[model samples]
Target: MNDRESKSKILWTLFKSMFMLSACTFGGGFVIVSLMKKKFVEELNWIEEEEMLDITAITQSSPGPLPVNASVIIGYRMCGITGSIVAVLGTIIPPMVIISIISLFYTEFRTNKYIAIALQVMRAGVAAVIFDVVIKLAQNVLKTKRALYISMMIVAFIATYLFGVSAMLIILVCLGIGIIDLIINLKRIERSAE
Candidate 1:
């Protein structure tokens, strides 16, 4: 394919992927990340698993929502700014349309006891899905530093849930530690090479 044709195809693929992710994901951005990995990394082979993880980290650190930011970054990596725009639009459209309709009818439907019970059940499902995603993410992260990452995960959980510390603060601290570790590792490798 020529450059333009290849770019167009890439943009279209990204748009479709983002659309599927935004539509199928019921819970939140984290769940969408798992779905994105399944589609983009496992199914489509558009990006590698490690690259997806790196994208997730960057998306988390930057401003705005995770899924949208991720879509843009992935799209840009795959194609360019045009691909990013297409992916972002695809990710946004489904949720916007669905939420608009739901918001219009929500008040009327929310008062019904059966509907409330159904929603409660759905919440349980969503929680299970979120937990599954967390476990998968933990598994992936733990592959490199099983003990340390697990300990950090536990500490982060306790700090956030029990001690009432902000997740943002924990994330910042972890990012700082990761950067220090990266620098140290690079220095060690460089010195060894020398």
Candidate 2:
């Protein structure tokens, strides 16, 4: 672990980290997530790797955008509500500013020949970045070495990909299974004490 950083230092680090992560990454939430993990978990050593993975999962399962969700969770974990507010602002401001500028010239941007080509190239890059996120997520899951999780992962994949089942259903089913597992473990612990 690194030496304890002061409150102001931590807040500044959180803001700068999120700003840089959000500003430069073009592919989207997943790309931002990958970069965030590298900076916060790997480089800065601010967050634990497993906790980072948990944050990723939570962000994915939440309603809003993953990067925003992650920033809020991580910031709160590190420095409480104030940190969360700052981190969220950092993440939001850049994209908001960029979109506002782009929207000003939306018609011209849409009609321009070179812009269309650049958009096509960006799409390809985004695809690659998404693929990288998938592989990284799978590796994290595999590291857990839990058969139930792996089976659930495969079932979720097959359900969504092959049969075209709704992802919401799969998520609900997994939620039920997790709750049941918790109940069963609690019962077993009680029976052992008796």
Candidate 3:
């Protein structure tokens, strides 16, 4: 295809992929994130696994909803601002429409035994997906083999799970550490060059 045609094709594919993933994903952003990694990093080869991990970290630490945050970054990485807009629309539309419909029939849905049972069952699946994502993230962190990174991961988990510390606090602490590590690495590089 020509340049214009190829760009159009990519945009279309991006929209379609996001829409389908959003429509099918039931649990939340974390669940969808793993699926996105598979689709974008593994299948499409559009994004690197390391980049996806970074995206996951960024989206988790950001203010808004995780899926929307991820959509913005991933879309921007792929096709700039237009891609971000398209991705966000695709990500939001399905949940918005579904929730609207659910609200309309809220009473009926709440009263229905089968729907309740189905939702309860879905929670188990969601837990599994979340667990898988956790394992993958931990593996990535471990691969770095940096004592500080590994220790921070364990400490953060302990602080969150055991102490019930605020996630925002943990994220901020991690960000500070990351910045220090970056600076240290830069200094080391400078010294080596000199």
lDDT winner: 3
Global lDDT of each candidate: 0.85, 0.88, 0.95
Q: Cα deviation of 27 in candidate 3 (Å)?
A: 1.1
Instruction: Compute the lDDT for candidate 3.
Output: 0.95
Q: Could you tell me which 10 consecutive residues in candidate 1 have the lowest summed lDDT?
A: 144-153
Superposed by TM-score, candidate 3 places the C-alpha of residue 87 at a distance from the truth, in angstroms, of 0.8
Over 58-172, each residue of candidate 3 has an lDDT whose tens digit, in order, gives 9999999888999999999988999999999989999999999999999999999999999999999999999999999999999999999999999999999999999999999
TM-score of 3: 0.97
- Total clashing residue pairs per candidate? 0, 0, 0
Number of the top-ranking candidate, with TM-score as the measure: 3
Q: Which stretches of candidate 1 lie over 4 Å from their true place?
A: 146-150
Candidate 1 is scored at a TM of 0.88
TM-score of each: 0.88, 0.89, 0.97
Pairs of residues at least 3 apart in sequence or in different chains that clash in candidate 3 = none
